[model samples]
Target: MTQESATVDPPGDELFARVPTEVSVYEVSPRDGLQNESTLISLEGKRRLINALVAAGLRRIEVTSFVSPKWVPQLADAEELARVLRAPEGITFSALCPNARGLERALSAGLSEIAVFLSASEAHNKANINKTIADTLAVFSEIVPPAREAGLLVRAYVSTVWGCPYEGAVDPARVVKIAEKLLDLGCYQISLGDTIGVGNPRQTREIVRRFLDVMPPERFALHMHDTRGTALANVLTALEMGVRDFDASVGGVGGCPYAPGAAGNLATEDLVFMLQSMGISTGIDLDKLIEAGNVAEQVIGRALPGKVHKAGPFRLRRSPTRAS
Candidate 1:
């Protein structure tokens, strides 16, 4: 095999004994990463970022959201951006649409895959979308079926599955019910989000364990934030539970407008680096992934919170006495 095609085995077999051989990384950088940026990113800049992510071998990317421009002006160019997207073969490009209006916009843009979002907590639901949890689900029920009938793949996000900024310690049962409802509403996959990043490994394990009883691991994905610095640990806990899909942002650049003091999503480079080091294939090039993160950093005009983007990959250092 060519050097680039060859796999790098994990340093120790025992460390990765329970880890899966492959994992699907859903890239949310173009959508979730930029939605909350203080400065507006030009269409050219957004296109450049998406191109870099595709070049890094990301097969699934959330390109943009069709939410009202009044709420998130950073993504006001969603329709225009959609028109300019250049997705190659084997790439699945998706956009988040809050309701029927947003879905109609996505369909008009020629997108066949779309994402819907609601929070597990009532307070977040009301705060985020200005609707109660029940009201939001009602809207989704109206939107999801029509989208599916139009030959679109529908995915749903249940935010604040672990804890809510306004309401602490979310009930696991509530998350399960929300996920079941989403699946019943014709969502092909459901992403459980630690929106405020208050979850730890123990909480993640318990959450996964609860969900696994009602659905297969493939039916669920994890969307974690690094606000508490335990995002990777939570991922490791999920990996051990056989959950293979994860949602990550490039350079960890986005946070919720409703979630006060919340950090960005888990950095894609950090997750890819850990997965690769543990002998798990993500079908993404670590070097190229870092390059994408760098591009995102440049677009945002600041250093990101991702460690790998700043420190680079880990390497063994030779002793001072060794030959130069």
Candidate 2:
């Protein structure tokens, strides 16, 4: 472990004015985290991982994607996985639905929540979904309405909001427009993704600033990859801007097959530690989350890139308190 020190600020400092008191951390490890890994995760292995995440107090978990096995071989058993009762009551399990077929699978699997995704870049959109941005929206329009009508909550993911792998930088306004359309299509929330993990704090503030102009921060979440190692910093910037909901993967194990060089999602343990240390509530037990990360590391068969999971939480021993 490395030694570090910080000057403790007085409680309720002015700098904390704009920060949120409580935040929602969305866990995406079982779905996005394991999607692109080279190692194939078995059904039982995935169940154990999900159980660990639930035990760590993650309420919103994306368990799997409803896509075809030909596309994502890792989650070939999405139907069976979806039926498993890993979490207790009130635990929201979501899955990514790419098209009508995927949406049908989600519906048949008895899922109450599903998410649809599209890239902000036309090239990446085409490469990922094999459809232009316009066509992807068209598909969403067709499927999102039916999914909503079926009494399921729908969420939207707008990838490459900051920068793209195929296309360098995306205009924030363009991303906002896509978000608006998805919302109009009945998505209750939108998740802005830094697919290539190329976002900085300044850029995050500016982009989120623009989104706030049109949509309330409560209706959106930030799904950041640690590819450029700025996911946590970018998240801090968002938190300072009153954004609460964030998507994180336990142990930071995820990547995009469509977007080359993209890293895993922000580590769940790191996000929880930072928020809890700053007096913001994430409602996650850091120790148990680290254990969950260990489960992820074992499942992935490699040492992950999560800092807090590797170093453990900061615990200092002091003499017993003296009586007043």
Best by lDDT: 1
Q: Ten consecutive residues with minimal summed lDDT in candidate 2?
A: 1-10
Error of 2 at 51 (Å): 0.7
Expressed as tens digits, the lDDT of each residue in 241-324 for candidate 1 is 888999999898887878888877999999999999988999999899999999998888989999898889987888779677
Give the TM-score of each candidate.
Answer: 0.93, 0.92
> Where's the lowest-lDDT run of ten residues in candidate 1?
9-18
After superposition, the stretches of candidate 2 with alpha carbons farther than 4 Å from their true spots are 1-14, 317-324
Model 1 RMSD, rounded to 1 decimal = 6.7
Give candidate 2's whole-model lDDT.
0.90
lDDT of 2 by residue, 1-324 (tens): 233455565475564578899999999999999988877888889999999988888899999999889999988999999987544788899999989999989998998899999999998898888999999999999999999999989999999898988779899999989999999999999999998888999999999999899989999999998887898899988988889999999998887787778767788998899999989987788999999999988988999989999999987878599678
Runs with alpha carbons beyond 4 Å of true place in candidate 1 = 1-17, 316-320
